[model samples]
Each structure stands twice: as structure tokens, then as C-alpha cells.
Target: MLRRLAAALLSVLLVVLAPVAAQAFVWARSSDALTLDPHVANEGPTVALIQNIYEGLTERDRAGRLGPLLAVSWRMLPEEPTVWEFKLRGGVTFQDGSRFSADDVVFSYRRAKQPNSGFSDYFASVVAIEKVDDLTVRIRTRGPNPAFVENTPAIFIMSKAWSERNGAAQIPDNATTDANFANAHANGTGAFVLVSRQPHVRTELRRNEAYWNRGHVALGIANLTYRPIPRASARVAELLSGAVDFLQDVPIQDLPRLRAQSGLTVTSGVENRTIFLGFDVASQAPRGTEAGGRNPFADLRVRRAMNIAIDRDQIQRVVMRGEALPSGIIIPPLVNGWTGELDTPPPFAPARARQLLAEAGYPEGFATTLYCPNDRYVYGEETCRALVLMLGRVGIRVKLVAQPQAEQSSALRRTPGPDLFLAGWGSPTYDSEQVFSSLYHSRDGQRGAYNATGYSDLQADEMIGKLSSEIDGGRRDALIARLWQKLRGDLIYLPLYHQMLSYAMKEAYDIPVDVSNMPKLKLVAAPTR
Candidate 1:
């Protein structure tokens, strides 16, 4: 009888102490990081995941404003108008205990500009990265760059000693299934240290006891576990069952249900990502299209027709559950140089679409494959399905080919990608130059890495190139507006809408929803009960 009573008492004590002993935060999302190497993949999930481990020269605050991280302060060189200097934060140590210095910044800059690194485009204007001293570094650009300062946050800093020792000096290209040590492992000087990672399964991170900003930031959660739940229903179920504490991408259909659940909070805001459709405009004979020996998308009339055929308002209502903001341009409002007048989507008119198609020599419309990802964007498959029906009404036959995000991204990067495909873009720099340089400019070694559409114009390229070096804010914005006007007139892409992001978490935790959809775990705070 004494033994039984003691055992029962121990069990009750464990139950009472479990919550306090294990203050872990489990976050679930639809997809996993393709690579932990910050320079390998310029993807949202990959960047967000690695951000917890990697520390950049600069970072964005909770309000999305530029702030200090690895670098304490930075300023433009007055004598050399094209140069910027950064003072590295002293007394900082990498997770492995190596002292942080300017050498690591220079090495990281060179590594990030390698051919395999997807972030090379961001540094296209950089002429040189030099170490002035152990604590100071300087970057010389081709010309005055207004966006350089804000763009630093995207370039993650890696320890030179750690990377060289691990044979990860070069980032493996994730597109070709190339694997390097950095692809699966990480070493950084951030608030969190990577404990373990199982690709497409789960990733575990523990608080860094030696974090430089320990008391400066709210580091309530001691541990974090990330689970990739591809299915929306499964993610919702995990959250509802208390198996997960936070969900990054909440489906619009479940917002109300999640909001009504006791002890749950759903924070929502418009994301910086703009979802749109692109075509192989430069391909002479694109595959998966009814047009033989020619590309129908090459015709302005057909492109305009396709643009008007998409009923953004209807998609926003039916498919998105009234959680999307319909847009006419690929750039979101959060980005610099965005104007409301320029973002007005074309009116949905099937009759007009048919007439335009007739004018483009496709009187009876044409059949084409619409490549989409099933799990990439929120309701991505459903959005493609709705697009198919909308185009069908105007006599366009759309064969929907929905695949996983990994496969879709691979296909889009190929020389001749799908004839028509859906893609979502987020401006990490929050600038129009990022959109123009990556999506609209002509494909080159430095720019147009994501221009799957094959849309290239020399004038557009020149304008974007000038926008990068233009120092005057008003002049740069005017150039941006001019480039946007040109893109609008050319109809290079069919703009859809800016995605609406909803983050569901326990009410005890207060997590702010940022436009980038990247919530820094260290900034998350849970009020004491």
C-alpha cells in the first residue's frame, strides 16, 4: 500500500511539473527548408529556417525596419560615394565559440557570390568587399546604390573557420540535387543553435546560452521544434490537438475555426509576396501549348487576354475565402515605389478576353498546360483550378499540372520551363528594383535568376540597372514608376494577388505578424500566467 501511494504521488508530481520543465515551442508549416545553407537557396522557407541559426550583418526589427545584428553600425563613405563601411560588433562569438570579425564578413561575401549561390544577384553591383581591420569592413559598389543598406539583411554571415573546416566553403546548388556539408548542417552566431535536423521530417533547435543578445531580446522559449505538415487539414488538427504551439501558414478556410478555439490566437496581415502567372514569352516554340511552331504568349493581345481572363475578385472570394488582396502588378504595396493607381487589376470580362484572343489569331482559343504547386502557396491547387475554369469560359483549354513545390521549383529553373506557370515572389529588400531585376530583366549571369517567363527587354534591363545605382530617392522612384509602367504596358506577367498570411499560436504567446511572413522566434514572448 505504501509503494502504490508513493508511485501515484510521483506520477501526479511529474504531470504538474511537465509544462514548466519543457517550455518548448513547436512550429508547423506546409513545407521544409530545402537547404540549411543560407546562400544555397533563395527561398522563403529556407531563409526563414536558417535565419534562426545564421546571423547577418544587418537585420530587420519587429517593425520591419533596418537594424543592427552582426554589425553594430554602418555608414556610407562620404569621400568614396560608392563605398559603404560596417563596424563589426565586438565581443561576439560564433555558436562554436570562434570570435566574430571582419574576415568572416569578407569570406561570406565571396562565398555568397559563387556561381552556385542563389544570392549572387543581390550582390551584382558590388565591386569589392575588403577588410579594413579586425572590426571594420568596407564594400565598394559599381556605383551609388540606394538599396544596398536595406539589402544587407538578406546576406547571412557564416563563420569562415567553421565553413573551411567543414569543406562547406562553396554552397551546393539545391536545384541539381547537389549536396554539401552545409546543406544539412549549420554553424552560426544567432540566438538559436541547430540541435538536429531531419529533412522533410522535423528540425530541432535549442537556445544558445552564449547568444550575444540574450537579455536584449525576449528569449522566452528555450527550445523550438519545426514539423513540416504538407496537408492543411493535418496542420490544423495538430494545432487543435495541442500537438503544436504555432503554425506559420494557416489556411484561410480554417481561420474562423482556429479563432474560435479556446486558448488560440490568429494573427493576420498582408504578406509581401505577390503571387502571379508567367509565360515563356521568349521561347520560339514552347512546349505544352496548342500553338504550333510559335508561342501565343509572345503576342501582346493574347497576354492581355489571359490577364483579363483571370477574375481576381472571384478568386479572392471563392478560392481565397476573402483573405487576399487582388493586385495588378507583381510588386506588393509593401515594397518601395508601389502606387495604388498602378495596382488596379484589369476588369474581369470573358467576352473581352475572347475578343482579344480572336485578335491574336486564336479565335477559338488554345490549349496549354498550367503548371502549379499543390503545397507551395496557400490554396495553390485550388487557385489553379479556379484559373482553369475561368480560362475555360473564354474557350482556353488549361490542363492543370499540380506538383509538389520541390518538383515545381526544379522545373521552373530549367532552361525552357513550363509554357505557363504560377509563382509567388517576396521582396526581401522591400524594393521595386528586386522585382524588376529578378523577374523582368533579361536573363544574365547576375540578374534574372527567377525570370522563368523568358521575358527580357533591353530597355527594362537598362532602367532596372540604373535604378540600382540611382542615389536620389525621387529620381530612383521615378525610374521605378517608369519601369513599372513599361511592364504594365508589355503585360510580361499576369498579376494575381498579394497573399494574406495568418499565424495561429497559443494565446499566451504574442507573435507579431510581419509582411515578410518571417517571425523571429527570439522576439516571441509568452506572458507569465
Candidate 2:
């Protein structure tokens, strides 16, 4: 009788404290972040989640403008334009109370350039990093790189002492299912601290009371929880039932019902990303294709036929629910050097596509596989199904293989991963050179991390190499235009459309949509009830 009475009293006391905990912000999305290590993956969702826990020297604001995060000021050397100096912010401390200094900056640069790091391409031009003093550091590049600063936002800094002490000196290779100290743990100077993480289940974070920029930014959230709900309807139900405070990537089919709800606010924006299809053009006989002895994609006529078979306008209307913008170029219009002339896509002609396929020695067409992620992007699986049907009409039998983004990414990095794959590209630097060098350029040690198609051109590579050092505006723009013209004639990729993002939240809070799709919780504001 005594034990039962005590248990009942404790349960009643816990019920009273549950509502206070519900005040914590719950952010729901379709999938979980791949890793907590910032330098491991360059993917958008991974970076967005890591940005809240880790910070860089410079950051982009909600308006996509350059702003200070860890560095107070930075300038290029007058005598040596290839060298840039940055002055670190003093009195800043990491979450573990470690002092922030130039040593950490230098250490991070070195770590990010390691062979296992996927972000080595961003630092390809960086030759050396030197610490002049505790608060001053200089970085020397191989050439006068005007886009160096623009790329800094993606290079997050880590605590050198913490990493070395925890035996996490190197980034974990994300290809294999390897375990490391930093894979599920985090140590940073950002606005949030990781409290707990259960992969594919949930991640919990609490506000950092000692955050350096607490006074400069508005951090209304006291606690944050990220829950991955793969089912679209379940994610929507969570928001409608008041179980979640915010929902990112709202499905297009549910927009009307969500907008009519009383306590919900939905905001829409055009993201600076392009969805496209790539092929293994350089292979003699691409893997997992019906063509036994020859690669059909090697012929330009076959590539053009594949491009003309798809209907981007119909995809924009039916699959995307009239929310996406039909695109012809891999780079969106928001990026620099985008022109209307190069953005025109080929008209959908099934008869022409069939004729071209027969002329290219594939009279009966061929069987191939299209690897796609079901939960990574909005309607990713649905889009693939539509393409499979459209391609079948043109005598191409495409088998659709859908999996989680994590599994799909691992497959993409394997040796000759897929003959045909669906992927997306976003220029974090907001420049054409980043897209050109990484996607269009030939795969090498320093560049083309995502060029799984083996697409390479000597002329394109030469122009892309010159772009790193070019400073004149007119000359840079001219090179970009010429490169686009060359790529258009080659038909390297089948451009689909620019994605439109929808974010829904409770009416009591206001959160603006960012073009990069990184919603900083520091910008979220809540009104007192």
C-alpha cells in the first residue's frame, strides 16, 4: 500500500511538468541528417542541421547576404591579392568553454582539406593557412580567387582541442557504415548544443546560454527537437494536431488544406536548386544497362533523344502541382551568369525521340535503372515514376529504384554506382563557376566530387580553370556564357525544374523562407500569447 501511494504521487507530479516541456520547439522533416560532422557531407539537409550546432567565419543571413559569424572583419592583401586575412572575434567560446582563436581556424582548414573529407573541393585553390597571432589569420591561395570568400560559409570550424582529445582528428568516411566519435556527437560555438541523438528516430538540442551572438540575434527557442517523419501524411497530421511547431517541405497536394487551417501559416519561396538526370557518357559499356557491348549514352543523338522524351511542363503542372518552375539549365536563374537564351528546354516529342533512338542503333531501345531517393526531395519518387512512364512511351524501359537518401547516397559514391541516376545541384556560392567546376568539369583529385557520370571536356576544363583567377566582370561573364553554350550543345544533363519550397508553422511564430533552404532557428520569432 505504501509503494503504490508513492508511485501515484510521482506520476501526478510528472504530469504537471509535461506541458512546460512541450514549449520546446519541434521541427519536423522527412529525413534525418547524415552526420553531425560538418566536414563530412556537402548535402543541403545535412548542412542545414549542422549549421545550428556549428558555425563558420562568415555566414549568409536570411536575405542571402554576407554577414559575420566568427570573424569580425576580413580583407585581401594589397601587395598579394592571392592572400586574404581575417580578424577573429575575441572573447568567443565554444560550447565546451574553449577559447576561440586563429589556431582553431588553421586546424579546421587543414582538416577540411583531408582526403576523406568531401569538402576538399571548396579548398582546392587554398595553398596554405597561417596564424599571425591569436586573433589574426591569413590564407594564401594558388591564384587570385574572387570566389574564395563566398565559399567560406560552407566550411564550418571545429574546436581543435575537443576534436584531438576525443580522437576525432579526421572526418569519418561516409561511404561505409563506420562509427567514429564525431559521427553522433557535436562540439561547436553555435546557438544550439546537442543533448541527444537517435538516428532515424529523433534528435534533441537545447539553447546554448553562453552563445556569443545571443545579444546580436533573436533566439526565441529555448529547446529544439527534430523528428523525421518519412510519411508525408503523418508529417502533416503532426502539424495539424499541435504535436509539432514547424514543418519543413510541406507537400504540394496538402497546401490548400493547410492554408485553410486556422492556426497554421504557410510560406512559399523558390529555391536556388536544380533537379536533373545524369548519364555515364564516358564509359565504353555503362553498368546495369541492356546494351551489352556499347554505351548508348556515348552517342550525342541518344542523349538528345533522352532529353526530348521528358515533358518538363507537365512535370511542373501535375507532379509538382503547379509549384515548380520548368528549367532547361542545371543552374537556376538566381545564380550569376544565367541567361534566358540558354534556359530554353527541348520540346517533348515522343515520335522524334523514338526515331532518334532507332537511328542510333537502338531500334528496340534498352533497359536501364534510375536510382532515386524517396524522402530526400519533395515528390522525388513521384517524379521518377512519371519519368519512367514517359520514357517507356519512347521505347526506353527504365526500372525505378527508390530508397532513403542515406542509402541512395552511398550507392552514388560506389564504383560505377549507376548508369542513370536522378540528382540535384545547388550552388552554395551563388555563382556559376561552382556548378561548372563541380558538375561539368572532369572528375579529378581536386574537383568533380559529384560528377558520377564521367562527363569531361578539355575545353570546358580550361575555361573552368581560368575562372578561378579571373577578376574582370565582363570577361568572367563572357566565359560563363561560352561554357553554357558548349554544355548545351553537348547535352550533358537532362534539366528538369527548379523546386519550390513550402514551409508551414503555427500562427504564433514567424519564420522566413531562405532561398538556400537553410532555415536558421535564430531568426524564428514567437509572440507572447
Candidate 3:
């Protein structure tokens, strides 16, 4: 017994005397870092770093449960579903050493709702934000949104004083004539600080030593660098030889090689993204339009023919090598807003497409250009090439225009010009309304922003409007189903497949891992070697 006691004491002493590992780490993503500003940074290429440098009021965990970040506790008003009162945790401090308060929350949210900002979801249900006290805040919404409370705190908070000081008087939109404060420097209470940025090149983040979270893994000094390499070969070579520690879009062809490497582990899951195809129904097709221009696609027979011609099974097996599945809806099943039932097949039947095209007045198959991004989605270019080959067999000539990530985002911004393009959408808030309203809402469609294809359905728009104002559970779900069924039948957007995020890591580079998409490397809880 005495010997055992002595060993225990020695072990304790050893732990106390041992030097702790430096609380620093670097996390990598596939694309070049565009911007560190979470508000202005909308693309997946930029979100990975955004997670590291900012803290929302709350964050999601591995189980996708909402937990505390800035606010410790909150309660709903008994009188209405739209009103919520929150009590902020008092001890939190910003990276600049200022104490967190209700005032910061108010400033961040107001900026989110500003005109033309891409991040209006932060105000999707929010109507009024009131600062009741230093530690108290109240949020009034347009209606009782079930996901309101869950999404509210996670909308990366910005500092009120800092915004005015930096002349970022508005919320960030990539369209702003000048960069917002968030674009230049981060003022959030997160674990990292934005040190420097060069668009489509590299962005660096340094660990925040004065982080508000203590006694946690989030307290660590760290450096993170991101670079966008569009070529699959380059990204794979970097990962295989360890020139880069990790890459996000691990190519399906190279997964085997990554797996065989002894020093790294490949990580992946069905990411919250769905890939889809769209048609522009609101405009006339040009006379020289590819695929026989607008008239062919406008005809119901032509649209159905194109749908019938797709061979999703072949793409899944050959292109993705069983890594992804064909989809029918915009939302992935992992998300709650997903549509559960649909029937679609693959190994595309050009013969069938020909018959439909003939019936729709195109007895001779036509040709067109497919606008797609080389680096946006995983293997986006390769997938386009495969589709081009498949469609070519059916008498449809497809020209491919593949550009880098920046030009791709620029094209998406144009909305209607691209004939048919491959695009992906993931609801950051994880809701159907977030998907439907952003893409299908007429208000947005009128501006030709989210509704790139100009898809318009009055009934579908009404359902979303009703859903927005609905405070009751049963009625809202029915409205959601109505919208789901409508979109499912109209078939304007042809969902290609959902995505799974892939991560590669060295086993020893451990941090508190979760799927909430919020990243913090804290020195306080850095693991001991």
C-alpha cells in the first residue's frame, strides 16, 4: 500500500514538472483563403478559417446539439413565440481584452440585416434586438421560428465600437464598395485573430492569448494558413508528402493513396451540402442559345427529357466511386428539412432523352455550354466532364467552361447568363426555410441573386411566407411539406448529389472535435505528449 501511494505521488509530481506542449496548431482546408470575415465570407473555401477566428453566442457539438458560447442561458416569453430573453455569461472577454456585453450582440445583429448583405439569415426570423442590460438581451422575431433560438447565438458577433472606429458602419457584403471592419480585422471573442489576408492566396490567423474561454481545450496559441490549389494533382501531392498537413477536398481517385499513408488519417462525413442543376424559366432563350436555347428547356417535354436522360447510378459508381449518392431535393437527408421520397435512376439513357427531345420539337439534338467551377465543389470539373460525355452520346453537345474559385463566385453573382451550371447549397442554420427562401423567395428572385435560374412559383412563395410568420408547430410543418411537395413536383432544380466533408489529420494533432463548424484551439486544454 505504501509503495502504491508513493507511485501515485510521483506520477502527480511528474505531471506538474513536465513541460506542456506549446498551445499552437495549424488547420488546413482545400481552397485558398479568400477572406477571414465570416459575414462576408460565404463560400465553403472560406468558412473553415471563419470557424477558427469567430465565436457565435452558441455552438453545435458532435451530436448537433446547441450549447453555450457567449450566452450561458436564455428563455422564451410565455406570451409569444416571437419574443426571447437571454442572459449573457458575465466573465467572457473579447480578444482585445474588452468584457463581453449585450451591446456587442446588438451591434453584430443590426449589421447582419443591412441591405444586400448575403447573411440575412441572421435576421431570417429576427425582428428587433433590444439590449436590456449589460448582460441581458431580448430578441423579437417576425414569428415563432423553431430554429430561431438555435441559430441566433451562432451568427458570429462583431464589436459595436470597433465597427464605427474602422468605418465598417454596415454589415459585410462582398458587394460593399469598401471592406467592412470584419473584412480587415476580427473583433469577435473567438480563439484566433485575423493577422493578414491576400485574396485567393493566403490568410493567416494567430492564437488569441486573452481568449474568454479558460480551463478548456479552446485556450491555445496557434497559427493557421490556407491556400487554394485548384489542381487535384497538386492538392494530393501536398497531402501525400506532408508539404501541407491537411486538404479539404480529398479527391475520390486519391482517397486510396491518402488512406495508405501511415502518418495521416482521412476524415469525411455527409457534409450539409446538396449539389443541384437549375433552369431559367423567367427569360427567353437567345436564338443562338446552346441546347437549342430557351424554348427547348421551357417546354415541359424538354425539361422532363433532360431529367429522364440523367444516369445518376453511373455517376455514383464511376465518377464518385461510390463516395456520393444521387439526390432529388436541395437539402441533404442529414438535415431536418430534407425531402424523404423520390425515384431517380442513372447510367444515363441518351436514347430516352432523344425521344423526349424529339417530342419537344428538337428532333435533332442541340448543343450548349455548361458553366461550372473547377474548385468549388469536390471534383466539380471532373463531374462536368463526365456529364458532358454522357450528354454527347445522346446528340447533345456540351461545351465546358471551368474557371477557378474566384471567377466561379463572380459568375454565380451574374445569376442568369450561364446556360446550365453546377452549384451547391448548404443551410448554415440547418433548416429548410433557409434553403427555400434564399433560393426561391420572389423578393430575392426579383433581384436575381439567390434565384439564379429565375424559378417562380407564387404558391411556393406563399408557403414560405406563411412558414415565416407561423408560431405554431403543426401548421408550420404542414406548410413546409406543402413547399416540399411543390418543389419536388415542379422539378426546376435537379439535385445531383449531397456532399460529405473530408478531413485529413495526424492523430497527435488533437483538439476538441465537433461538427458544429466552430473551431477554437485553446492552450488551456492543449494535450500533453
lDDT of 2 by residue, 1-529 (tens): 9999999999988776543322479999998888888887888778999999999999987667888889998888889999999999999999999999998999998998875676777877788999999999999988888778888899898999999999888776653477578888899999999999998899999888899989877777888999989999999999999999999979889999999999999988888889998888887887778875888988999999999999999999999999888888998888987878778878999899999999999989988888888888889889999999999988889999888988877765554557888888889889998888777777676677667778888989988888888877789889888888898889888999988888999998878788899999976754454
Stretches of candidate 2 off by over 4 Å are 1-22
Q: Order of candidates by lDDT, top first? A: 1, 2, 3
Stretch of 10 with least lDDT, candidate 2 = 14-23
Candidate 1 lDDT score relative to the true structure: 0.87
What TM-score do all the candidates reach, one by one? 0.95, 0.94, 0.88
Off-target runs (Cα >4 Å) in candidate 3 are 1-24, 171-177, 218-221, 286-288, 291-295, 343-349, 415-417, 445-449, 510-529
Give candidate 3's error at residue 454 in angstroms: 1.1
- Model 2 whole-model lDDT (C-alpha atoms): 0.86
Instruction: State candidate 1's TM-score.
Output: 0.95
Task: Quickly count the clashes in candidate 3.
Answer: 18
Write the number of the candidate with greater TM-score, choosing between 2 and 3: 2
Model 3 poorest 10 in a row by lDDT: 511-520
Model 2 CA lDDT for position 479: 87
